[model samples]
Target: MSIRHGLLALLERGPMYGYQLRAAFEESTGSTWPLNIGQVYTTLGRLERDGLVRALPGGEGGQRPYAISDAGRADLGRWFTTPIGRADPPRDELSIKLTLAMSTPGVDVARVLRTQRKATMAALRRFTRLKQERAADDDLPRRLALDAMIFRAEAEVRWLDHCEAHLGRPG
Candidate 1:
């Protein structure tokens, strides 16, 4: 998720402590992607080490404040503008497991697909409910994130249906 870059973008707004940064991040996107406080601090430390962020001297807040340097701004800009290509070697754990199942003898493919369909429907329902609940927020970023979740869930549901319909049927 390039959380380090996300933190840099937040810091660009102004100097902020880790807790404030965490809250700001969660609020801005409604945290479709969650982050632990420890992870935020870890990223902050890395940014500081990388000369992207500098700690305020003698600050005594529960979470220390950091300001973005010019280098940090440049890095944030570069990160945002960079295009992300598909990973050279895709790392899909689900695809790997399904491949093994398909190869193994005496495995009921329909049963496997039905089980996955159940799970996917549950997830789809969850996302749908969340989207309905957020319908009134009217915040662009949060709305966009919710919309993304809904779209992905719907896509998974369609794929599950397709898999179930085609299982064990050779073309």
Candidate 2:
């Protein structure tokens, strides 16, 4: 996830300090991705330097809030419209590990798949439960985030099954 764009998106809501941005981010995403306070301040500094956000005068609590600039609005708008490309996909560590295991002598790929399938299924169950609990709440962002995670976990399990089946077939 692009922390820069995320901060800008939150700032689009209104002026917010580093702490406020961190809290709002977690709340909006259902705490799925927690941000470090230091990371938040660092990103804010970069955003301010880039002129995507401008620092506001210290509030009553002396917190230095930031507001999105016009450029920031344009950047955020572009981010929203841009479809995430598959040209440079993120590396799947699990896939890498499985591939290495298959090539390494004495390494049991089947065992690895079984272990990962168990863990992924456990995560899927937890996500499903969370989704059910939050289903009635009027929280679209959180629901969307949870749904994405749940679906990804389900897909991973399916991929693992496919890998096992492929291994069993005569070469």
Highest TM-score model number: 2
Residue pairs in clash, model 1: none
What is the C-alpha lDDT profile of model 1 across 1-171, one tens digit per residue?
788998999999999988888999898877778778899999999999999999987667555789999999999999888888776865766567667888899988777777887887787788778778888877888888877887876887787687667765886
Report the error of model 1 at residue 35, Å.
Answer: 0.4
For candidate 1, report its TM-score: 0.87
lDDT of each: 0.83, 0.94
Top-scoring candidate (lDDT): 2
Q: Write one digit per residue (lDDT tens) for candidate 2, span 1-171.
A: 999999999999999988999999999899989999998999999989999999988575777989999999999999999999999989999999999998999998899999999999999999999999998989998999999999999999999989999998887
Q: Model 2, 27: alpha-carbon shift in Å?
A: 0.8
Judged by lDDT against the true structure, how good is candidate 2? 0.94
After superposing candidate 1 on the true structure, give the runs of residues whose Cα lies further than 4 Å from its correct spot. Answer: 87-90, 105-107
